[model samples]
Target: MERKTKLALAKTATLLAAIPALVYANASGPDPGLTGVPNEAGTCAACHGSGTSSINTKGGSVTVALPNGNSYVPGQAQHLVVTVADPTAKRWGFQLTARVAAGTSTQAGGFKSTDSNTQGICSNSQLRTAQPNTSGTCAASVPLMYVEHTTSGTRLGTTGSVTYGFDWTPPSTDAGKITLYVAANAANGNNQDDTGDHVYTATYSLTAATAAAQPTISAVVNGATFAAGIEAGSWVTIQGKNLTTAASCDAGSPRPGCRTWSSSDFTNGTPTSLDNVSVSIGGKAAFVYYISPTQINVQAPDINAGDVAVTVTNGNGTSNSVTVTAADFAPGFFQTGRYAIATHQDGSLVAPASVIPGASPAARGETVILWGTGFGPVSPSVVAGQTSSQAIGSALAYASAPPNITIGGVTATTVGAALNPSALGLYQIAVTVPNGAQSGDQPIIANSAGKTSPANVLFSVR
Candidate 1:
C-alpha cells in the first residue's frame, strides 16, 4: 500500500516476513494438488514446477516473485516458502498435496496429520523450525521448507515441528492477492481426493506496516524558510514536513512546546510561513521534531549541505542541533542555464543588461536605449540632459535612479542585479538630446548623471 503524506508521492519502508511461497495459478485458478515427491519443494513441486503456476510447498512458503528480469526461466534456482497452522492438528509441517487435497483440519489447531501417525506437534513459527520430516526422497529445494531443521545450522522452532522461512529479495508492491489451491491428504499416502468435511479455502490479509511509514525529503531551508527572514513586516509559513502547524508538539527551549521548527525541515514559499494551520481534522500541522509544516510542503534538509536544527518541537521538549548535514550542495551556479554568474563585492547581482541599439541626443521626440546592468524591470522615471563630466563620453550607466521599486507593495526585491555584460543585464532609456544644450558631436548626458559620454558616439540635435 502507498503511504499518504498529503502531497507526497513516494515513501521510505522496512518490513520482514517468514513464509515465502510460489503458488501455481492457471486460467482455472490454483492447479490440482501434487503429492509424494522427493525434492526441496516436497510434493507440491509436481504442480508448482516446470510449465505450471503451482509453486512448491516443500521450501516452506515460496514467494512468487517478479524480478529485474520480467521473464522467468527454466531450472532457475530460487528461495521460497509457504505456511499453515492447525493448533489442534496432529503436528505442524509445510503444505503438502496430502494436506491441500485432504482439506485436513487440526483437531483444534494442530496440523499434525493423524495420517503421519505423529502426535503432539507444534504450529509453524518463522525462521525457528528448520527441518520437516517426510516419508520420501525429494528435490534439493524440498529440504529448505523445514528451515528450522536442526541440520540447516539453527533450529529456530520447537522439536519435530515444521515452519516456513527463507531469505527473500521481496517485491515492489506488497499489496496484492495471492492464492493457494493445491490439496493435501489428511492421512498422507496415495490419496488423490481432497476428501474432508472441513475442506475449504483461507484468505491471507495484506497490510502496509510500520516500516513503510517514515518519509523521504529533499529541500533548501534557512531563516527564510520561517517567513521573510526578518525582512517582511510580519508572518511567514515555515514549510516542511509533508508538515502541519498545530498538534500536540513542542518548541525549542524557553519557548518549549508547540513552536520549535528545525532548519533541516524548513523551506520558503509564496508567503513564507503558512497560516490557518489545521489543529484538527486534516490540519496543516506537521512533525515538530522535523519542524515540518502541515500547512505547506517541505523537503528533507540534506545533511551534506550543512543543514542545522533551528528548533525541533515535537510532542517532547524542544531541542537544538549544531550539525546535521552529511555533505554540501552539488556544484555550480546558474546550474542549468547559459550564464556564468558569480558572486560580486557589492552584494548586488544581475543578468547581462539589455542594450538599446540607438537614440541619444535626439533632435526632439525620439527614443533612446539606455543599456546597463540594472534597467527598468518595470516602468521607471527618466531624465535627460547634456553629457556631464562624470559621463564616460561613449557610455551612459543605466541605473536604478532616485526611488526604489515595489510591486503593488509586495516588495519584489528578492533578486539582485548581476552586472555581467555577456549576459547583457542592461536595458534601454530614451529622451530628447535636450532642446538647447551643447552640440558639436558631443556625448549625450543620459538621465540626470553629470557623466560625460564619449564624443564620437554622440548624436546631433537640430
Candidate 2:
C-alpha cells in the first residue's frame, strides 16, 4: 500500500509539472509573455512558429518614441511610446528591455507602466513559482525585464495595430549610452496559437543631455504641507516652474542665504531679501533662505489680518501676484510626506530615512526642535523680516487656545515655542518625547482651537 501511494504521488507531481506547458500550448499566446531583456527573448518561434516571409518586412514594424528627445538627462523621467503597425493584424503584443550599450551589456535604468493593460516584469527574473514553460519564460533568473501587453490588453485589439505607453527613469549618472531591445508580435484576431503571427525586433539608442535651464516659481506653500495659508514669521516654500536649475541644495552649495542669515539682515524691520532672488508679501520683501530654479524657501513677512498679495522675482522674471490670508498663531511644522523637519539640540538634522552616518533617529525622552511657519503671535511682536542676534527677551504670544502637540499619540511637553532668531515667519518648537512613546516612526500633529494640521505627519522615535 505504501508503494502504491508513492507511485500515486509521483504521478500527481508529474501532472502538476506539466500544467504550465499545457496552458502555454493551448492558449493563443504564451501565458505571461516575457519582456525587457534585449536579444535574450529566446525566439518566439517556439510557439508562434516561423512564417513564410520575413516578419520584419511583412508591412509591419515597431517604433519606439521617447517623448523628451532622442537624448536623455540622467535621473530624468521620460515617457516612452511603443507602437506596432500592421494593416491586417488584429491583436498585438510587445517586449522591451533597456541595457548599457557597452561593457557587459547589463540592464540599465528602470521601467514603469502607467497603463493597466500593460504589465512590467523582469525577464526570466520576475516569475511566478508556477509559470508557463514558453520561450523567454520568467521562471529563471534572467538579467533583463520586459513590459508587455496583458491577455486583456491583447484582447482589446480589434484591427490595424496598438500602442503602449510607459515611463522610464534613467540612472542618476550617464551609463555611456542606453540601448533598448524590443520584440513585437502582430497576431491574427482568430485567437489561436498558430503560424498567423509576425514577430519583429529592433534596437534604439539614447545619449545623455547637457545643461537645461534656470529656475522658475509656481506656487508658494507653507513649509508644513499639512497647513494652509502662510502666516507672518512662518516657514514657507515657493514652488513653480524650474525652481532649481541644477542639483538640489546640498551641504557644499547649501541653499542660497540659508546659512548666512543674521539678525542684522532684517534690522530696522525691513523685509529680508537674498541677492539671488526676492519675494514680496504686501509689497514688503520677505526673508529668503533657499533658492532653486523651481522652488524658493522663504519666511513670510509680518502682515495684518487680511488678504495679502505675494510675488517672487528672479533674474528671469517676476511671477504674477498670488494672494493669501494672514492670521495669528497659525502653527505648522515643516515636514516631508513621512516625517517632520526636526533637529537635535546640537542643531544636527533629524533624518531617520537617511543612510548617512550622522543622520540618526530621535530617542525617547530626547528633546528635539521642529521648524515651521505660522505660529500666530509672539510676546514682543516684531515686524515682518525682523531679526535679532540675542535670544527672544520676552514671552511668546500663545494662541488663544494655544497649540497642543502629540507624538505617537502621547502628549509631549512643549519646552520652547518662539520665533526663529535668524528669520521671521519661521517658528521653532522644542518638544520632549514622553516615556511611554512608542519607537520607530511616530505620528505627530499640532492643533489650535478647531483647526488641525494635515494628517500623517511623523517623526522618528528610537
Candidate 3:
C-alpha cells in the first residue's frame, strides 16, 4: 500500500508538471493572435492543425451583456458577462478584444480582472510586431485590449457552456462607437493537443451615450439604521437615479438576489470608484460599497462636524451637490431582519439559521460578540478607504457613557466594545449570555448616547 501511494503521488506530480505553464497559471489565453479577428490567422486550428479544425457558428456562440440597454456610459465601471456555449463540448477557452469602430483598432477604454479566472492584457500593434510568434501577438493594424480565459476558467464537462464575468471601465470621455471581437474554443476533454475542437468568432458594438442623464442624489442616510443623517466614518446610503447600471446588488456570494463580487473589488479603508461610481462628502471621496442605478452605498470618510457638500459621480459626470450634516455620535446597529450582527466567541455568527457548523442557538453562559456601525470614533483612528487584512487593535469612540446591551430583556455584562480592527467604521461588542435569557429567538437591543437600536431585529438563544 505504501509503495502504491508513492507511485500515485509521483504520477500526479508528473501530470501536473506536464501541463502547460499557461494552463497551470490560469492567467489568460495561450496567445491572442490566434483569435483570428485581429491577425486573420486561424484560432485553435493554428496548433490543433487544420485537418480536424471546424467552425461551429450554429452550435456555439459568444455574447457580451451590458446593463444599460446595450448602451454604455463613458468611464462607467460596468460588468461584462462573456458567455460561450456548446452542448457537447467538455472544455472551453476564449479571448476577447475591444477597439474603436470603423477606424484603427486602437485599444479603447480599459479592462480590469474582477476574479482570478480571467486577466486583462493591454498592448498596441507596434508592441505585437516586435514580439516573437511564440509569445502570441496582437494585430499591428490597431491597438487592442484583450480579456482571456485563465486555467481554472477552462471549465470541463459543464453540460452547456460557461460565462466569464469581469469589469470594463469605459474611457473617461466619449470615444464614439466601439467594437468588440471575441474568439472562443470548445474542445473535447481528452488531454491530447489534437483536433476534435471548434472555434467561433463574435463581434459586438456599443454606442457611447452623450445625452445620458447625470446621476442624482435624492437622500443620504445612516448606513446601519437607515435614519436621515450622516456621521464621519459611518456607512451611508445615497439614494438617487442613473447612479449605476444595475438596480440591486450584494457584495458577498451570488445567492439568488445577490451579486458575487470578487475579493479585489471591495477595499476596507480607502475610497474607490468601483463600478465607476463614487461619493464625495465635503469634497473627500468616501469608500464605496455597492452601486445600482437608483442607489449608492458607501462609508463616509472622516470629516469635521457640520453641513457638507455631498455629490455622486459616474464616469466624468458629477451630480448636483446636496447639503448634509455630521455629528459626533449616531450609533446604529447593522441587522438582518431583526437579528443584530452578533457572533459567538469562536467568531461564528449568531444567526437564526445554522449556516455554519454549530453557529446558531446561542446558549446561556457563552460569550458572544455583536457588530455594528456609526458607534462614533476609534482611539487609534483609521482612514476611510484603507484596507486592512489583519485585525486592528483600537477602542471605539463611545458616547458620554458606555453602551447598554440586553438579550431577551435580560441585562448582560459587557466584556468589551471596540472598533473591529479589520474593517472601517465597524464596531464590535463582547458580552456574556444572561442567565435568564430566553431559549428561542429574542430581541437584542443596544443603546449608546441616548439612541437605541431598531426593535425589529432578533437573535437566537438556546
Candidate 4:
C-alpha cells in the first residue's frame, strides 16, 4: 500500500509541473519589441507560426481604428482600438507601438491602458510593466513603450473578433508624422501549442494637423455707415478672416473684462498695433482701436485722397493688400438701422421709447446732440490717433466747414459741430429741432465738402 501511494504522488507532481508550460505559453501578453516595427523581432508569427504557414494565410485580418481619422494634434490624447478577426479562431491577442515616421526605431508618444483588457510595457533590453511617468513619458533608458492584451483580455472561447482599447498621447509638440505598428494573433483555442494560430500585422500613418491660417482682408469701409470709403483721421472698419490671433477690447469700449492692449503695445505714441495686430493704409500705420478675428476698428492715417492700399498683419502673417477709395471727407452718421444716433439734453437716447430701455422721441424746437464720423478735419489740427484736446477752445475742435444740416427737409440751425473732446475721429453736432419739422420719423442729412451722408438716416420727432 505504501509503494502504491508513493507512485500515485509521483504521477500527480509530474502532471502539475507540465500544466504551467501549456497554460502560460504567451499568456499575459507577449514580450516587448515584437510589434513588427523596424528594428524589432518580426511579429507574433515569430513564435505562433510553426515555420510552415505564411502570415495571414488562415484568412484573418488585423486593423486599428484611430481617433482623429488620419491626423493628430500635438499634445492631444487619442483613443485607439486594435481588432483581430477570424472565422475559425476562438481566441485573440494583439500588440502595438508608436514610432516617428522619419525614424521608425525612435519611439513617438506614450501609451496608457484605458481598461483591464490592456497593459503597458517599457522595453530597453527586456520588458517590464510600467505606467507613464508624471511627464507622460517613458524613462529615457527604456525608451520604447508597448501596449498589448492582458491574460483575461485574450477572451478565450470567443469567436469572430476581439478588440482592445487604449489611449495614446502624441508628443508635446508637432512631430511632423508618426507611424503605428501592430501585430495580432487568432488562435484556434486548442491551447496545446501555437501551431494552429494565425498571425496578422498592420501599420497606420498619421500626420500633424495643418497650421493656423494667415490674416485675410475682404473689405475696408467707414466705421459708422459701413460704406466703402475712408477719410483722413476717420474711423475705418476692416473686414476680414483671421484678422487677429485673439480678440481684444478697447479700454473704455462696451465689452468688459476682455484683454486689452497695455502701454507696452504703443511705440512712443498712440498704439498702432494691439497684441501684434496692426493695420496699414497707404503704407502708414493706422491706430488700432479694436481687434477681433473678423473685424478691426482703426483710425485711418492722414493719407492724401485717392486709391490706397490696406493690409492687416498679425502673428500668423500679413494679409493681402486691398485697394480702397480714400478721400478728404466721407461723411456718415452713427445710426441704428435708419435712425440717426442722438441724445437728448438730459443724455437719454432720442428714439421711440420702445427702441431702447430709456428712450423718448425728440420734440420740435428742442435741442439734441447728434454723433457721426468721417466729417473731414477739425481746426487747430488734431492728429489722427490722438484724442481731441479740450484746451483747443471750449468749442472743442470745430470742423473746417459747418455741414449743411436739414431735418424733415426744413433747414435746422446748427448750434455747433466739432470733434468730440474725449474720442478720436468722432464728431459731435448739436442742432435745434426745426419748428417747421413734421412729427414722426424725419429724414436728416449732413453734407460736408460735397460728400453727403447716407440719405436713409432718420430722426424721431413728436
Query: Model 3, which residues run further than 4 Å from truth?
Result: 1-210, 245-269, 354-359, 387-401
lDDT, candidate 2, 1-462, per-residue tens:
999999999999999898776744323333333333433434344455374245576677889998666688888778889998886778777777677788424666766777665666554433332232223223236544456666666754578878888877776798888877777778775655476777776778888886354444556667677346667767777777654333445555644433444455556444355545688887777777666556677777666767888887755447777787766656677765567889998977776756334667888889988886676766666565555334354445333344678888888888777666665566678788888889878888877554556658777888
State TM-scores per candidate.
0.22, 0.44, 0.48, 0.54
Mark the regions of model 4 whose C-alpha exceeds 4 Å error after superposition.
1-207, 247-267, 390-395
What overall lDDT goes with each candidate model? Answer: 0.25, 0.66, 0.69, 0.83
Total clashing pairs for each candidate: 128, 38, 15, 0
Writing each residue's lDDT as its tens digit, candidate 4 over 1-462 gives 999999999999999997886467477777777788876777888778664256777788999998688888787788999989988888888899989999877888988888888888777744453443333477889888888888899999999999999899988788878999999888887774567888888889999985557899998999988886689999899998888775454555633212445566566778888778889999999998878778888899889999999999998779999999898888888988678999998998898887767888999999999999988878877878777773354447988887888888988888988899887889999999999999988899887888888778899998
lDDT of 1 by residue, 1-462 (tens): 344663253322211121112211111112212323222222433332232233222222322223322221222222333333222222222332212112221111112222222211122312122233332222233322211211221122333223343322222333222222222211121112212101212222222222211112222222211211111011122333433324334444312223434443245411123232221101222222223433222222212223333332333222222232212111111210222122222322222232222222233322222222112221121211112112233333333431121211221221322122221222223232243444333332221222221212223332
Ranked by TM-score, the better of candidates 2 and 3 is 3
Task: Please list the residue runs of candidate 1 whose C-alpha ends up more than 4 Å from where it truly belongs after superposition.
Answer: 1-91, 95-163, 166-177, 180-214, 223-462
lDDT assessment of candidate 1: 0.25
TM-score winner between candidates 1 and 4: 4
Per-prediction RMSD in angstroms? 23.7, 19.3, 21.6, 18.1
Clashes of 1: 128
Tell how far residue 22 is off in model 4, in angstroms.
61
The window of 10 residues in a row where model 2 has the poorest summed lDDT is 128-137
lDDT, candidate 1, residue 136?
25
What is the per-residue lDDT of model 3 for residues 1-462, given as tens digits with 9 covering 90 to 100?
999999999999998886766354322364655555554444655654233246654377767777765567788778888888876778878877667776634566767767766776645554352121212233445345677887778877765878898877777788888877777777676645555666667777889975567778888888876775567888888887877645456665443212323466645534467666777898888877766767667888888888989998876479989998887666767876666777876777787565445558778998888887766655545555542223233444433345788888888888777766566677777889898998988888777776566666687898
